[model samples]
Target: MTDDTPAGRSPSRRTLLKAGLGAAALPFASPAVHAAARDVKISMQRSSVLFTVLKVKGTLAERLAPLGFTPTWHLFTSVIEPMNAGAVDIHADVADAVPIFTQSARAPLTFFARERGSPAAEAIIVPADSPIRTVGDLKGRTVGVSRGSGSHYVLAAALKRAGLSFDDIRPAYLQAPEGAAAFEQGSLDAWSIWDPFLAFAEAKRPVRAIANGTGLTSYHRYYLVNDSFVAAHPKVVATVYQALVEAGQWVKANPEAAVALLTPVWGDLPPAVVAAANARRTYQVEPVERAQLGEQQAIADTFLEAKLIPRRIDATDVRIWTPPAVKG
Candidate 1:
């Protein structure tokens, strides 16, 4: 896999391994005994630090071992397209707005888990010396943002709150690394992005956030699975969900340990920056509920209004998988 580092620098093999470019197939039961164990392919992103922790700890693999399955992790910079195409069985997590775009494409996917809202985790930022002090100042300025990312919605909502519209700005659709490069090179007037990247930029450069998704959006992240995977391996899905819940609890209870484990995998980000980014995320994994989809619907509507999505869609129309109840 290619390195995600900005500025066209190549990553060493060791760094790539640490960054999870090499698929991690955790050991199951005795090799001789479970030689035929099925592989449960899981896709992970650097921002989803909980999955990084779990992958490093082999937590999901351990949990699925008894079910005759071994966990294999594949790192990804963007997960929606691969997920929709059935390239991965489970998507670690993605911004709230991602699933909406996937659903609009009629992808057969199901929401299994979500992190509670951490609205401040994402923001619209400008260089410290830039004259764009407020969201209204963004009108007609070039803004760098990932197309269909949660930060995209953050920019749109922030603009609307300031009485501006999506069409008022010139958008540079870019991934995190490219956006950072452009923003630092003075090519972009502003950038809309989420943490670790957000935290990393602040540490390396002078920037200021003009607005984040506070009242505008909850910024909840969601985990999804291809519907075919759910049908073929319901029990495995349940086990993975339970593992995520426990992993979330573990990360919250042991922040320092989580940071230490994640720093290397996240491109050796400083421990402090990793902690700051983690601080902005709730990481409280919970089952996706229909009632909680209000923000999702709002996101879909906003994207539709902005003409970012191809067509209108009912955000709650997708399938949801509920975990089994906990035993006393």
Candidate 2:
């Protein structure tokens, strides 16, 4: 199962937009192609601070224009679905735990870049006035979380640390927006969520962090491309990666500009909330380091133990995008 996609000349936009092949997903490992290109199909969740910056800056489009890569972005709350469906070529700002599930399913995904892990950015929150104070108190309570999300892993790990399991707690699976609403309406005892949402909840209501990713999960947001997509147009990955790095730097150095541009797009995410989300994340994007994949493996093993994924996964075994220069 190797993608022996030839690497000679750069592909045009027509070559890049061809989506990944589906169906073998995660039961076995195979080589993913990331060489040819037409237009780059990308997906970004709303809370992906760095990608949101990219969307706002339009830098990827500008950089890719000369290469004949038309950038198409879709908003999908979850990370793996679009890639799994072959509807997107690239998905950025995903969590460490997500690709593990995809790899478990043997899907065609390549983690091209990684951000420095920052553990405190995501947390399980309860109303500040609520009686539940710690992870132990969550037993038998209805908690909201997005299935297969970083927050989901955090919540599970937090429960295990407190001597509880998923069965001990009533888990309500909801996307980010719905979870926030459910939490606000007092429908959930606790909400496990990540930054932007975590920051939004904190700013909109009085909430207390019951547990964060610290000592539990690395919470490293990732940039992934469809296995075939990367094999088809590896340079597209490189170009986008470079743009993300610059945008991340610009975001940190100019908070006001970042917030002002994103506030409206983020459904009126307050300047403070947007700022907090950015502050918690490291925007420095670089090629994925093989040694650093242990955090992902931990998440996969945890999911396997909990049966969230059908089987075990060696997360480090999947495709990783190294820049062409590195490859040469």
Candidate 3:
């Protein structure tokens, strides 16, 4: 879908006001109240579509900054690295990553928000010259991934759909940047990753897409926050979600403008690549549906079956925002 949404154009004042009313409904506490509250920090991955919401001078920061909230951004090479470190209040990446943390005896995190569409953002790519034509070609070969991420789950489900398992192939656990370099070096056989990085690798290397997470995996992006953060500042939580949703809507309608914003944010990425990536995604933030939950929970079960996680988790408890409340 080509979205020629012009830049420098703002959504009408009426729309902004309605969004403000939505923001007003959020549980924002006064500064005096916030002063007495604990400070919470948020960590975001560098290349994930979620960054489109967090870019410097981006719509997300501009909207939330005025709300008396300060977001401290941490750039991790991969999603799971930040989550496992326990370094931030909320981790934003694929929704599937949440269950891995839940199943590991870690505290069950609250599901704050979700991207309406999967990342036109991530996919599995192979060298054009390679013999691999379909998912089945992955048998007995090494697939690179950053373990415990949406990309990780994408590969897991892809393998299962192909009548294969993690054991059928060698898993090279590496962060995305490293994985990209490995792919270019020909040391990595097949690589699965999220865009910007996926776009980056595909630009320099002649690659054939094996499969995207779209059909095989639930492409929902989730915000995972500690329970304390959710309980203490429900208002701030809603504010963040609203800003993200607005930004998402903007990106959906204006692919070219979205690419222009990302070009500087992503640092000189070709316009075509950014546009291509943006075109494949839907940016709305909403609660996960039950069917989406079951698909993701099945991934958690697969992780347990693969011994990637310590034990089985219920997966349902990770959801903090109920669907009814998400309906606007």
The model with the greatest lDDT is 1
Residue range 209-260, candidate 1, lDDT tens digits: 9988898899888999989989889899898888888888998899999889
TM-score sort, best first: 1, 2, 3
Which lDDT values do the candidates have, in the order given?
A: 0.80, 0.74, 0.64
> What local lDDT score does residue 139 receive in model 1, on the 0 to 100 scale?
89
Candidate 3, residues 43-69: lDDT per residue as tens digits? 554434544445444444455555666
List TM-score per model, in order. Answer: 0.91, 0.86, 0.79
Top TM-score hit: 1
Residue-wise C-alpha lDDT for candidate 2, range 251-298, written one tens digit per residue? 879878988986655555458887887788877767788888887888
Ranking by lDDT: 1, 2, 3
Candidate 3: stretches off by over 4 Å: 1-40, 58-67, 81-86, 289-291, 322-328
For every candidate, C-alpha RMSD to the true structure in Å: 3.5, 10.1, 9.3
List pairs with backbone clashes in candidate 1: none
Q: lDDT for model 2, please.
A: 0.74
Q: Which residue pairs show backbone clashes in model 3?
A: 27-235, 121-195
Regions more than 4 Å wrong, model 1: 1-14, 21-33, 326-328
